[model samples]
Target: MEEQQKKEDGLLNKEETDTLHVDQILRALNPRGRYQILHILLVLLGIPSAGFQLLSNVFIAKRVPHRCAGPPDGSGWSDIFGDTGNLTIVQGRCKLLLTDNSSVVDSAPCVYGHQYKMPENASVISQFDLVCDMDWLARLSQSMVIAGQGVGVVINTFLSDRFGRKTVLVSTSFCLLGCGLAVAYAPNAIVFVVLKFLIGGFQQGILVSKATLFVELLPVEYRSVQSWLSGCTWGFSMMLFAFIAFCFRLRSLFFQTYENDSFMDESLRWLIANGKMKQAQKVIRRIARMNKRSETTILQQIQEKLVLRKENGAEDSERPHKLVGQESCQRLSLLDVLKVKRLLFNSVCLWFCW
Candidate 1:
């Protein structure tokens, strides 16, 4: 009788009960509130880091050009002047507009300033020029940094369905980091372009998985708009990147590069989504400590979700699943869709209707 009661009781253990409480709250306060919270959190997460990254880049140029170059020239002026020089690289857009100048009009095949600039003092092989070509091609390269991010979004959407969220995130993260590093150190312009493309592809996969995983874990009401809002964060994130890019000029990879001022930002969300919950907890604890706040154990949160999902799954799958009228309806086979008679009839009908 006790066992029967235990099984029959709807009340769950500590975890499930807490989850139930949260569900009740979700149901009580409109889902809109939670989505707002989610959006706020995402924006909060994306903006500050982006700002820091930007400001840090500026600081690197102004305060620490030595960090990029081997040593400071004992004069602090280069650091200040570096910011002024960095502008030429980011805002220039002559590269994309006129692709074939020779065939078309006054346009000529534009290359980077670093590529063909002839040095006055050096011989044919040794001559160098610091002046960038400032053509449409360079403009396209500038646009690609943000365009690549959008590509990441599209790529992630498809991959999430095929390869599961966690796997895609980790694999893509590793790939992005590798490609990004390669981009930072590519030997030539061609190699740099290839690496940048790879970085964009991998980044897209990572973002999709991140979005899917977050939505899956979020409460249902929070899931709807929050999903779309998360996407909005990416747009906002681009602005953030632009800010950072403006500040953090990438003129030279090793000798000079912008710093990302993400002040102690070990993204716990990234760690948790990647199955590094222990590390996440450590991060949470550290944050709590730094802020002089109390830390909440997520273990209970996990246990509750597990029980709730398991119970829901048991309730769903225990009974034989069935197809409804729309689902059960036979889809027209390809043969039916492409039948010659059907095509002719449709064409004739279209002609008559038109």
Candidate 2:
């Protein structure tokens, strides 16, 4: 037990160039190291990505649902929401037949909160009134999630090349945390729409940085395992959604919409990973209580990590610089893509007749 504790705390006092085992990776990724912060940033960046992939499935599975789908006079999916709750495959709606008393309802404020409805409502299961219903907002959120991830990929690439993986990671993490909450606090529809795009763009940057770190940290032999781990985590996340849907029913399982209105809901895990250690520790303890696990060891592990990190600061300064100058590094830019595009178009025009 003493040896294991010493092993976990030894990274700072010494630098070993040996191959890393799964235990090493877990220590780097999970317990209380900056690596934990790195991994959390990487995974949370994936939230929007996973959110994007999951959104289409969400839309298809449940069409524009409403609180009372049919009419206030009726109850359940049909009675409460209306015929619009009915799934139509023609429009890519899920072939779901809500056998349960409840059909998925459009919980968007504009639709669900509307005091007055046109006597002849034209929206089908696929169509939610974009003008009134906040469904557009939700859609926008999903788009931003994707867009942010895409942008994060590019920006993080530049960051990786210019800065060390750790620096870029720190930048991306703050961006993600800030942008995520900004989205939650968007004042009106327009703010929500525009910032959502920005958030998606930035989220992509974070992922690129994450991949660089993960790949570099792995021994070449087990790099494939890193890939597998990513795939497995995503698959696991899908199952998480399934569990949420099953446990709470679909209403409580939206990617963006949750009863909790604050930014804390945006990322409880993130709060802990990024220097909010005490807060994160508190959250984890609560989780431990819920799982009926003994957290005494976990708390001790965290303490050891904090101590190692302090020692690590001195260690980093003692090492000679092993990296290159940014000036010589090729920083790919959007302009480069445009130049390639123009060259391709000119070549095609010259060689082939329209």
Candidate 3:
């Protein structure tokens, strides 16, 4: 009996030593190889588009010089400096002056809509006639995009964790493309605002899921490099956005969405964590082939590691013992942050910075 117990203990130690974590397996499979480079490049393609979507409104809804319309065609600017005795320009943008024999009779609102000095239908401001009382609608559309981003971060984080990163990333990319196109052709200001909100949400989903997938796939040593690369890409994309806006103006928003539809591989770590052994094996084999490593050896190692992990998990579940206060301590809430002074301060600082 004593010898049997000793043998069981020795086997447990051996199994523990043989079991490999996801990070170790990634490192063994050649983390910084052809596969990683290709994957990183594909992911980076979407970052610039995100920058364009975020800043597109700056050019698309730019304020153009305008004044109230006048008599000749009712769509032309009022002859403020002309010798027109019937109509005169008012001091403010909303009101127009009407006079009889150079004596002010009354001030009238822009009855025929304002005429913009810019090209016809150049911007939402001119297209929707969003001047004076209606100008607030343009500003609201911009704010809605920002509000959508904030909401998307919370929602996509939960969705990615539940349905896997690849699904959320692909779905959001397609949705963003659709929403972007719709916004460009929106028939009214309301439709434009609604589509911009959805675009912002999908854009954020792409960003969150893409970042999570990229980080999880890389080895620990490569994560810092990924961060630096992502930052540089974003900065360069912003600069490129300016150039695109200069050359193409609002037309740039329509083309930026196409690049985000590139093919992307599912994360190996996510597959394994979600108990998708077959898919995980398939991804591993692909990675091995792309990295020019021995597929058979890596597959064998991964299988043994997974088997050991399953056995360990089963054994843990069979155990009926429970630690005191473990159940209560397992969960935390937002209130806990308020309870801790240091945590509260840090949270406030981060919130302010963001």
Which candidate wins on lDDT? 3
- What local lDDT does model 1 show for residue 37? 48
Give the poorly placed runs of model 2, Cα more than 4 Å off: 1-141, 245-354
TM-scores for the candidates? 0.40, 0.41, 0.78
**Superposed Cα RMSD, model 3:** 7.1
Model 1 clash count equals 15
Judging by lDDT, tell me the better candidate of 1 and 3.
Answer: 3
Once superposed on the true structure, which residue ranges of model 1 sit more than 4 Å away at CA?
1-158, 224-232, 252-354
Instruction: Give lDDT tens digits, candidate 1, residues 1-354.
Output: 743343333222322232233333223223344333443464336333322322222222222111011113434323333332322211122331222323322222223222322222221111122123413333343345456656765667556554456667667756655665565455554564455555556656655565555554335666667757765775676566555555535433321322221233333333433344355455445543444443332333434555666667745335342221123335443356356787768867865963
Candidate 2 C-alpha lDDT tens digits along 1-354: 854664444321112211112233233333434434344445544554434433333532244433333334434344433565445211112122333345442432222233223221222122333333345555665576566666666666766665455555556556655655554444555665566566666555555555655654433466677787776776666667655544533231233432111222112222322234344345445444544444565545644554575577735445443122222235456567557878667757854852
Instruction: For model 2, give the 10-residue run with minimal summed lDDT.
Output: 12-21
Task: In angstroms, give how far residue 13 of model 3 lies from its true place.
Answer: 19
Which residue pairs clash in candidate 3? none
lDDT of 3: 0.74
